[model samples]
Target chain A: MNSKTAIKFSVLLLLFVLSCALSLLFGGSETMHLSDITSQDFIFWQIRFPKTITAIIAGSALAAAGLILQIIFRNPLAGPYVLGISSGASLMVALSILAGNSFHVFSDFFIGKSFIVVSAISGSFLVTLLILLISKKVNSNVILLLIGLMFSQICGAIQTALEYFSDPNSLKSFVIWGMGSLANTTNKDLLLFVPLAVLCLASLLFFIKPINALLLGQNYAQNIGINFKQSRFYLILISSVLTGLTTAFCGPIAFVGIAVPILSRMIFKTSKQQIHLLSTVLLGSTILLFADALCNSLLLQVSLPINMITTFIGAPLVIYLMFKNKHW
Target chain B: MKGEAMISIKNARLGYKKSGAEISVLKNIGLDFYAGDVIGIVGLNGVGKSTLLKTLCGLLPPLDGEVRIEGELMTQIALSELAKKVAIVLTEKIGGFNLTTFDVVAAGQMPYTNSFNRLEKKHKEIIKAAIEVCGLKEHQFKLINELSDGLFQKTIIAKALAQQTPILLLDEPSAFLDYASKHDLFLLLKKLAIKENKCVLVSSHDLDLLLKYCSKLLVIEEKLAHLISVDEAKTDAAFLRIGGGFI
Candidate 1:
């Protein structure tokens, strides 16, 4: 890396460290003094640390997935949610949560968590399979995007209809999950979430060359010896897994995926995947950790939904990117 | 000058396969391209110039017959193996996410790089050399979206140069270039062919420029491709007919 790129990376790294520290120190309603380390140990280790880790994993995964989608689809507006992956997960979760006692698998803690995760992943994969099949027939990226939107709309309609017929007791839990929370994950959940997120993110390194070639268009990428179909399959698969896992755990957090990638491009001012990947991941984690900290520190009595904070920040950044003259 | 043919096309039929049906555009083409040869492909719009280039570069398969590269059948060669042998520059505009001239040019070394796309010292030298040859040293770090049409065309040419392939194919490469850049482009192609013993094929509508720079001309008409030397092209009936208004 050149000195300019190194400086940019240093700045981002510094912000990431700051965000992590801020989150660990001020992440819960119960404020504790550092001097009384033993007295505050339980809250710090049990609650604050896990929430921070969850924010880091979910944020980085979503942002990187968004970046991959934007490059693969060659669309500026493509995001983790654009392909209806999140909606598919939401629809499945709604069936389990809102369908009342018919699916009583949610009664046990371990079974409930695993079942929710499996349901979300299966739902997203089913939708991804349908989209991949359609992609082979369509020639234009615009057409694929329209088809994805149509799928998302269809999934949303069904989810809404399910919600309409559910009981109020189950509806309350479903609505809370939709609001999104980073605090629900404990140490046990980290065993699965951490490894899967890391694997999906690391798999991207193998595709750095193909993805770079693809930026010039499919013809150029193919001319450079990339198997366009195979690469697309792997890229889409990685993105869906990342999106599915995050949505399953955190409940479809919004805007961080789309907004962070565009922000990284504007800051770094280059499209080299190596640099963009690092910056996007770091910036993603930093943004979420800071947002989560704000949710905890500002409203001590009532913790705000993580999605509300992210959309509030991410929406305006996206708007600003749209108006800017530089192409991304 | 012709010890062995670099590329030999044997009765190749070029066209698109739409929904499992072959739509042939040009047929019965037989030709031999040797090293140090600068050939220009000329035809009317939508007359299969691009299709022919695509076929030679392994982007599209011929409807029938075979294209042999270095004595091996084209269909038998893997795409990865073909990448080291041939490079192409098409007419399409590439819009990417803040891709700089340097980044795009660096991608040319991808076929040779490791899986991580690392650029060693030698790879960096090759990329720098290509940039200098294409007169894009001043704009090497500039974003592609910030470049003019002419410079953008030059950047793509530089990328093809960086690939360092034995055969280079370009389709309508001069379409977006200015007059001087177009002249420089042909001059560069000719230099690369003769000095480096590379086979170069370019397709364009610039008949005057082609006649001035190309060693030979391949003219397409009525689903037929006719190969003629530059001197013979001056008096060829098909060439005269196609260039009637201007030549």
Candidate 2:
């Protein structure tokens, strides 16, 4: 790393630490104090701690997934949310939550949670597989992005139809879930979410050689001894897993996946996957944690949904980037 | 001077498959390529010039027959192994965000890098040597998106050089280059063939340049390909038909 990159990395690391600290302290309806010993422990351990950690995981996971999608698809606008992978998860989750009353099996708390996780993962995985198939026949970037948009529209229409028929109580719960949140994750959910996200994100490091080769385009990647098909499969698989699990635990958070990777690229000014990966993770975590903190600020009478805050911040960042770098 | 052919092709039908049908462009090709040979491929546009190069580089499977490299079947050789023997410079323009000229050239060393792709001292030296050879030392750190067309083409050529392969294949490499750079590129290919004993194949419409620098010519005409000596090419009927007005 050069002196400029080192300085930038150090600043990002510091920002991440600060964001984590602020998130833990002020991430609940009532801000908890570190000074008080007895009354604060319950709020800190149960509510604020899980919410803060969930933000970090979801942020970094989506960021890494977005970076991979951009590289593989060679499109700057690609992300789990935009590509319909998150909506695939949402579609399954809608089925489970809205129509789940008929199953009765989902009434059992532990089984229902696990089922939701499975449905989300399988939903996103199936969509990712479909996208991969279509990408083979359609090589143009604009066409692939349009296909992704079409997938989202189809999935959204189905979800709306499902919502129209479901019981009012179930529909209400599903609506809240769709808006996105980090507060729902308890310590138990972290056992699965943390390991899966960490594993998938870390494994991305192993494919650094192939991912870097892809920047030259697929044929060049193949010529340099990188297995283009295998690499693309594993990359999309990992990307979908990150998107699925995050959507499972914390609704479909927007903008972090799309905006953060671009931000990292802008900050670092290098396409070397190693630096981009690290910077994306750090910036992603920081942004989400800060957004979560903003969502829970005492100034608001009712706490806003996490998605609303992220979109408010993420959407503008994306628009700015699009205009700032026309080619990006 | 001929001893053993470095590459041999027998009855290879080169083309692509579409909707479960084979569309053959060049049929029943037989040829032998030796080290220290700089052969230029001449054909009209869309006459399977790129397809032939793609097939030679193992990007496409031939419809029938076989291609052999150093006595081993092309299909039998693994991509990783083939990567060590062949390098290519194609015509397509690539855009990689924040990718510098140095980074693109460093990719040529990927076949030799470790799992994490860490560039060792020796690898860095090779990358640097390639950049210098391609005259990109000053623009090494510039982003590829910022470089002009000629500089970007040079960067890719430098990448192929870093691969350090014995067989080099280029498809319309001079399409974006200026006149001076195009001459320099052909001269470099000639030097690599004669001095380093590399087998080089270049496809271009620059027949005059090819006649001046190439030892032999691979002419594709009417779904047939013929590999002939440059002197023979000057008198060949098909070559004259294609280059009749110019030559």
lDDT of 2 by residue, B48-106 (tens): 89998899888988999999988899999988888989999888888757888999999
Q: What TM-score, computed on C-alpha atoms, does each candidate reach?
A: 0.92, 0.96
Per-residue C-alpha lDDT of model 1 across residues B91-138, encoded as one tens digit per residue: 888865988899888888888999888899999999999999999999
Candidates' chain A TM-scores: 0.90, 0.94
* Model 1 ranges with Cα > 4 A deviation: A35-42, A96-115, A125-151
RMSD of each: 2.7, 1.8
Alpha-carbon runs more than 4 Å astray in model 2 = A36-40, A98-100, A107-110, A133-143
Top-lDDT structure, candidate number: 2
Q: Model 2, A1-328: lDDT tens per residue?
A: 8999999999999999999988988776676676742565877888888888999999999999999989988888888888889999999988877545677757677687778887888888898888877977997876887898899899989998998988798788778988999999999888888988999999998999988998888899998988898999899889888898899888888888989989988888887888899998999999999998898894556778989999999889888998899556
* TM-score, cand. 2 vs. native: 0.96
Q: In order, what lDDT does every prediction score?
A: 0.86, 0.89
